[model samples]
Target: MESGKYIIVTGGAGFIGSHTVVSLLESGYSPIIIDDFRNSKKFILDRLEEITGKSIVSFDFDCSNQEKLREVFSTYEVHGIIHFAADKAVGESVLKPLKYYENNLQSLVSMLKISEEFSVTKFVFSSSCTVYGEPDQVPVDENAPIKYTASPYGYTKQVCERICADTAYASDHLRITLLRYFNPIGAHPSGLIGELPLGVPNNLVPFVTQTAIGIRQELTVFGDDYPTTDGTCIRDYIHVCDLADAHVRALESNSDEEVSIYNVGTGVGSTVLEVVNTFEEVNGVKVKHKIGPRREGDAAQVYADNKKITEALHWKAKYTLSDALKHAWNWQKNLDESR
Candidate 1:
């Protein structure tokens, strides 16, 4: 938690990771990045430098590589780790369950081993609201039962949360915080870093951006007959920057607990049609979207009850949905211009 303490951020080049790196530097913490560039690119490092005016140190290493990860820990004076590396595509995870398990589960185990070996106790894990699979009640909370995983990726998060808990229980020195994030949308305010989906995007905001930028044909609003107020799937779409800030706060807390779980979301839910409408309003352009049949493994509605994190960490989502959409639009515009 000290100013000069070296904090290792796995998957630091990715969307949320890059934004968290910016937050870390802004908060006077020195962050060392570890990424394989499997899903992310090196351009994010340059973008981070541009945004924070600070040179970041990064290692092109996979968190699952035990030997290589050990070398990273030995080389750097890593005091804490904010783990963000994982395979996150829900649909792809269903097709490639082993791949998700390997990347998500193995990397987390390796990271914990390294953390224990090197005596780096402070840990912040990137968990997901998907762990609360199809909550029986609206506005799901931290105490909500971790239902059956909708996809392999969601199962990985649930597994990792258990791993963190078990690891902490065995080791009295370890302090782990699991942040169950809801749908993270938008980009950094500087428009230098944003969600860069490879090939095609599975998330809604990126698909909306791609559609607006003409990279994709149109946005497909999956399932228009869900049992929601709008008859469309509703999700608590938190801003990426806001989600990133939660990591910094968690890392700084320096608690001695085995594991603490918090839902990182705006206690509000927005439907798919509502998001598209907001995108159109924010960009001042109509989004070509169509209501499609419900995709397999898709949930009807999922929003967070972010009271625990708000009270425990004193962190609340500051940006509104309008702000998120505006930033996302700006990033999309920048992407278009660069292309």
Candidate 2:
């Protein structure tokens, strides 16, 4: 660990970023949160303090802004960086490819340039499994081919991974770990902070929670026509807490490789129907859902192999899918209570 031992969590007030902040603080690291509050809210920082019992160091700014990025670097002796500040909606990316490409790529490029310039040795990029682009095989391994992405959001991850690799290949001091995470669901167990999407949710768990809470009319199970166990899409839903801890593990793991890419997931595939049923079964909340047509660019089934990350970082997911749903439901309830 560097002297200051401060980690810069870009997009730190958002879903995964907020949970990661909790893990970072618990694991003996100071986190400096930088977010533009476009997809997140300022109240989340307060909730983070409630969860961790520590004042969060945050800056309200976009990571792509070179001046604000410099201010963060200069203000804090940043030893490490976890880049999670990117536009991440698949459907939105499909409709607005330019916006996805611009924000995702530019923010990452700025982070890399700053890391290289300031000699920030440890960097973790929040990549996604969408880079797989519906792999022909099940349980995608780290060596899985980087197929053409289905959306501009995914394409951004693929390109960012390459950018990190290329930058690491050229720099002797920089070490990059690209964590290709699967579907990350759930919130912090405290109910103080969790996945709170602005407006409608694009992911499954939040939508399910909202519907279960009567915030939304019903949950739409997109594309149940896929050739899966239930004719619905299959994904490995890892708890956001586990995924957050993996960031700390990645930062602390010892690796000589300049750039290491690992698939972070639960190594288990659960269909959309399975997730919905499990959520209802565990939480006793009936989610009125409908099986709709297959979404475009929707994969038949995609989960992680996860052997590489376990062996490399000595990390494995500990929470079950039901645990994620329970936490998600609790978080929704807390949000209602807070309101």
Writing each residue's lDDT as its tens digit, candidate 1 over 188-262 gives 988889999998899999998889878889888888888887889999999999999999889878566788888
Off-target runs (Cα >4 Å) in candidate 1 are 1-3
Cα error, candidate 2, residue 125 (Å): 0.2
Question: Model 1: clashing residue pairs?
Answer: none
- Cα shift from native, residue 207, model 1 (Å): 0.5
Candidate 2: tens digits of C-alpha lDDT, residues 1-339 = 234679999999999999999999999999999999999889999888888899999999888888878867887789799999998888889899999989999999999999988889999999999999979898899888999876888888888999999999999899999999999998888888888787889998889999998989988788866788888889999999999999999999779899998898999999999999999999987999987777777888999999998988899899999899999989899899889
Best by lDDT: 2
Worst 10 residues of 2 by lDDT: 1-10
TM-score of each: 0.97, 0.97
lDDT of each: 0.90, 0.90
User: Which residue pairs does candidate 2 place in steric collision?
Assistant: 223-294
